[model samples]
Target: MSNSVNLDDIIISKRALHLSENSSLDEMADALQVQQRGVWPLYDDNAKGLEQVQVKTFHYAQCNVKVQFNPARIKSSAAKVDNKSIKERKCFLCTDALPPKQKGIPFNDEYLVLVNPYPIFPRHLTIPRLEHAPQFIEPYFRDMLELSRALKSYTVFYNGPKCGASAPDHMHFQAGNKGFLPVETEYSKLKATTDRKLFSNEHLEIFAVSNYLRKFIAIESDEMTLLQTAFEWLYELLEQRGQEPEPMLNILSGYENGKWRVLVFPRDKHRPDQYFAEGDENILLSPASVDFGGVCITPQEKDFKMIKAADLIDIFAQVSVTDSYFDELCAAYAKRVVE
Candidate 1:
């Protein structure tokens, strides 16, 4: 739309920039020449479809997170997996969150607080289901216990799978460092939601508008039971809502001051790294929220300059529950349909 874009438009916009994996700020400055796009986009050819980033800082950006695949690759990966292991397999999480210490008091009909084994952040924990089922806003209980700590002053986080998860399986949630993304942005914005009467959890926030493009944030509760019950209804609805589910989902939660926040992202975005996939010449397609927002920091300049911002967006958005991934996901559900 704006001429602010360059000839390569997708790959390298006029403001386009790249930061190789594990790179420092100085290294980034040396490569950009102008030394600062302030906020630039990111991508991975290793990725299969539309996915890019928009970030405010480069020097401090970890750059450790990189996509390893796109939907095509995801489909391929899913296809290659041995489905024969279907029935006898145990949920990895149930196995790992083992030797259960004292379980916290159950919060709602479907939700409960439990310890997370492979934590992404400190006190990494989960607000999962008591029945062990899958749901999209899963791992996310509208706003569960892992809240108070994900605030900017506390920690940062990255959700995967359903909302950006590497482990699309296992019913759980995670909270981590404030380095990349603080957990409070969603919390402070809760009061701004449209239906103020909806939440009773007292901690859930609600947005008056869809805050981020394709992204909506809110926390609501009419009462603890209302919050819990509404979610129970949501759980029943999710059987038809969150595709096949891989039979599970995870949420990246954050917050502070008694309130909780969450980002219900989709995971199918992670692709294996090129080195991890095939050879040194291979590329990885790891897409993050920053990339979809417009600025992505890739380890290679080519990824930043190769795909168009719009192109990446189109692909990433498809993973939304309302999109085609639903068709593929639902088909999987149909197969597992219980008689």
Candidate 2:
């Protein structure tokens, strides 16, 4: 799945080149509003949802989880993920198929960063590879870290092919305004309460977040090489447990103060059973990278109205890896890496 287009041939605007890295991305988002008619209409949809959106905030000792009813996300929430169904549709991410008004900034000669029409955050973006490819993180984890650094006001995230990615056939990442997800603000507090240190070295430290209700691993480092190595090791450990092309996981990364902080959510399932339940029990909730980051989106009003804190707890527990497996994996991680 490769496209023949050469990234260098793509012309980026002179204004895009003159602005600072972070400012350039901000301007691109702003330009999308005036350049693309679809942007604000969708934003208006978000505003409408916010007004009518039912929300339930679960109180936990570690952090609070916010669930929002956003009907605009139904397409993504209940996307047809089967290979046949995927093949039947046009690849929307492809440049030739993109909306005429949509424009993007060339990123590192391999990706195009564009504003996302259906936004989960106040400001959201989707960055896709020039060539079509499967969604995998190992090859691009370092790039995610770099993007996080370049867009200092945003957090970069990845959704695995079997995770929440709607365009599983295209290698891509997403960026959202910082502080939108509770995880960004609650990480340090959660770390203090839940950190299970696996390995520590001069520049890199790895910890498994044990008490955050969902299973996740955190990697922090000032050195990209060291962080990449540790991340690969973690990937391998998770990969060995399953036979998939890559492990089922989602990633969130942020960089500040000369260091990168990455959180990995290991998943055992995509949609929870409630999504498939009979009439009265069915919920249109699908967990994604943002969900793991503490904001769950439900595209149906009924689902949002009926869902409770306990239901959310159950959904997370069912999708995330079991506690015992996480503990064993952490112990193995400690032994696999030498400080």
Candidate 3:
């Protein structure tokens, strides 16, 4: 059986790029500056059967084989911005004072699912916080515990307010279905490499996958102390690294192989939404779900846009451009502290 086999017994693989040999990446990115709307279905000609793919900015949907673009669906993620839009940056994630909102899954005290009108995905969801506080995943630790416990089947992730959050005001989280990621499986099967430091005992269990680009973790165990200890080790490392110096960070976490996994994304500077290349006022262009998932989408239909998925993978591996600003800080601190 071919690896491309799906439920329908169709085997598919990488087909081809959307642009021609003459098309340059700069041209594609320049085109995105003017307009941001583009997507193309992919097919594997050598597959056993015909498998058509529905490519989104963040994901590829196919019955037979999964597919994604190399760079990005669009050239630039910059978006138009205005004070009016900025002023409206209320932390809607934890707006319990509001009413119960629903997108796909039902709402609970811990977390609620709401449709993000200005979404990268066609039906993107915003997991809001009930406390209505500044955006931070640790504050609502129980929420993550409950949300993950309830939505055991889903993939939950947290992008630190200063890292990749579009709204850094209110604290909230995100959850989506499984199988949307490429490395989710590969990460699961990954054995411990020499770079990792395992922390496990009767009470505390923590394992950190210390490679570049992707972060594999084993966060959950039968014991709660293990989780707490793991979190502490992670936080201590964060403290040593001085990640607090940064304004934000991007993070991706999910469950597979019967354990939890986490990847710490980084950033270089605190840039506003304009960095994304949105005409008016929107700053984006870094590691994100669509980018990591090898798919991406743009809601705006002003011009033809296309996402390069392979670009995302490579970009993520460049932690300084993506991972939280902890590695350099911590590594330096360790050197200073020891020296």
Candidate 4:
């Protein structure tokens, strides 16, 4: 850590340095891959995870949902995040516990941008807080947006502690190389087809996309202050509705052409019944931000091979906010906008 370093300074200097050195995300990704290959056997083993993964796509309700059989993710997909379990394990995101060779770029002088050993995208990064902090988002979402802007070629996402964060004990966000998720391509169509605009001003545009299989609210703005204010308003509303600590949600953010697009999925359930189901009915599918964004991860081959369009629709219905609830939230938001 340097005394002269600040968020703006880090953003400007790091991107300038990296752009001069690597020129593009692909080159930087290759550098990370090379580094991981040299020191991280786990990463090398899981980089091979893509090879063993079998992918199947299904068109459900006009949305293309892809299921991937990723056995290497079983440990994460089935982690017991109960208090007892979390307390027993060493916090892997902690700097001291990190592998010696795992290097990272400084972020805001309070976080580190490191390559994710287990990746869902070809180039995935885990940005964890320098201090061991409980997984929380509202306080650091502005930072997430800044990271997205700095990365430019990647989409940043956050999984709530209970919703999908494997390291629930630590505050972190992940970035994946753009163009990986179906949601990125389908979003434009979704806005036109299913999303209902809830708020629009010079500074921001907010839309609720409930009919898009998974219900979520999308906010876009070029100004961080406006976006942050809107998010806080939504947070307060959800909290008043009794979502403790914070609303159970997952977020996906992307920055391009001077606009930051953020999608927030409000959740009522953690894992669906199929996760706890017996024998043949069991599917280890966990609905994370990426899952809500259209790519579902199935850690078991059988589940991946067997999950159908109807099953996906059902899983989404079970995990996402109910249609009625989403409708109510949208209505409330619309009314607030009008008032």
Predict model 4's lDDT versus the native: 0.81
In terms of TM-score, which candidate is stronger, 2 or 3?
2
How many angstroms is residue 232 displaced in model 1 relative to the true structure, after the best TM-score fit?
A: 3.5
Writing each residue's lDDT as its tens digit, candidate 4 over 19-71 gives: 46535543454465566666778888887777666788898676888888888
TM-score of each: 0.42, 0.90, 0.55, 0.90
**Superior candidate under lDDT, 2 versus 3:** 2
| Tens-place lDDT digits, model 1, residues 1-339 | 124322122222222334555543223222332222122221112211223322233221212222221232342233211234433455443323333222232333443433333222223234444444443444454345333332233332334443444334444444333443432333344344434222232344333222232333233443444444433443454455444543222333444444444333433334333314444444334444433322333444344345344433444454334444444533342333221
* Candidate 2: residue 109 lDDT (0-100): 76
Error of 1 at 37 (Å): 32
User: 178-231, model 3: which lDDT tens digit per residue?
Assistant: 555555554444434424335445443444443434443345554334444444
- Model 4 clashes, total count: 0
Looking at model 2, residue 276 earns an lDDT score of 92
Model 4 vs truth, CA RMSD: 4.1
